[model samples]
Target: MRDCNIIKDLLPLYKEDLLSNESKTFVEEHLKTCPECENLLNEEIEIESKNTKPLDFVERRIKKETRYFTLAVLALIGSILIFIISYLNTPRHIEYDKDLYKVYRNDKIYTVEFADKVSGIDYTDTEDAIYLDAYSTKYDEIFNKRRLRKSLTFRKENLKTVLYQNHESMPNMVIGSGEIHQTLLPRLFLGFYARLSIIGFIGLTLILFLIEKFRKKAISLPIKTLLIGAPLSLFLGIIAIKGFNTATYYPVTDFKYIVLLSLGIYLFFIFISIFKEQKRM
Candidate 1:
């Protein structure tokens, strides 16, 4: 006869039909000869039958929730990456070399210089033009680092003619004297929209994380929070766009694209989370 302790330990496995065939045979044979063991096995089987469905259902739910949690994490990471790239690509400002341009006049042949200090400059002859415009090397370097290609546009004040710069590269530092602006680059832009985008990204992330943490409490709650996150992101994006429109530094076009990209990333995360939730359900 098998030991009672050993048989009792195997009773739960036998009740779930999880024991190997040899083990099942041993348990069955032992049960037949042992009345006490037989009663214990029967009781275990009855108890498992009563609670098995509920227990299985709970197990499956936990597994599904864990999967959804992983998906949420991936979605958040993706959105953050999108936001960063968009910000980097956005044109913050134009950089120029202030000391890079000079003009020399010789009766008929006026000499212009941007020798080696900048990429290039384009000029438009205008009436009442008293000065040559130039920028410094630091200006060009700053722009190069920011990823915005720079060029100069010369507009004649008297002639009312505007020249669009088409220089292939920064002009060499020029030798000559002209009235100059202290700096070609604007010092600060008061970037409203860019700030908004950052705030919105951070806020959305926090909200999503909190909602996901307690999602198991009520399935509908997380879904509702997701819905809120998307719209709030869009609303903030729009506000940021408005701020961009008013700001002098970043162009309106850049603001629009940045907002659109941020919105796309935010929506993508929310939709994916919702889709995974539905699948698990």
Candidate 2:
């Protein structure tokens, strides 16, 4: 039998099928008679098999990361689309036709009768409460009826409940109420933020992209954080815009749900990104 040293040296090439035909024949013949050499070969095979398990695990991890990145990209796109839709769909201010709304004073209660003939107007949905004001100065009539609705800011006690006629057509509308002191949506501290929320979002995303570009190391964490922060920023901006004091009323109560919806989408993306990041680690 050949020395074990020679067989051990040839074992690696034999395992890989790289050995010459004559050399392979010699190694097989030697192994048939040598128990120690056969055991050595078996151990090598086991070691290689063990090593392949980790490689398989690494491959799975890579696949998972790719999937997560794909989903994150999709989420990012969806968020931008939602922001645009919210901005366009948001009601700028409450408007009504002055002629259609006739004020009649009753005992203790004031009744405002709205004309059923009023049509072709896009009115925002009403909140639980709305601003009501009695304007003595007549507004210059325009083709747009929305400009005719007046707004006022005052304490709740100063507001009077004005009953409406053809209430079904008006149906929970905030306009035509005598006093404009009614609350629409909860006030926000950052009301100015709403005015420029979309611009702010765009700036923020651009800054994050630039930061990722300059950083030598991976910026996946920061990028992910930015992605998660975008919707929140937009939501706050919308609330700020709605809550800020203005001559004409911007309805906060009606559009506030969009803010919640934006936040929900952001949270969903954040959790998914975090889960993917943790699994990768």
Q: Candidate 2 residues 110-142, lDDT tens each? A: 444444333223222244333332222112222
Each prediction's TM-score versus the true structure: 0.43, 0.41
- For model 2, the run of ten residues with the poorest summed lDDT: 133-142
TM-score of 2: 0.41
Total clashing residue pairs per candidate? 25, 7
What candidate 1 gets wrong by more than 4 Å, as runs, is 1-34, 45-56, 95-97, 100-160, 163-219, 238-252, 264-281
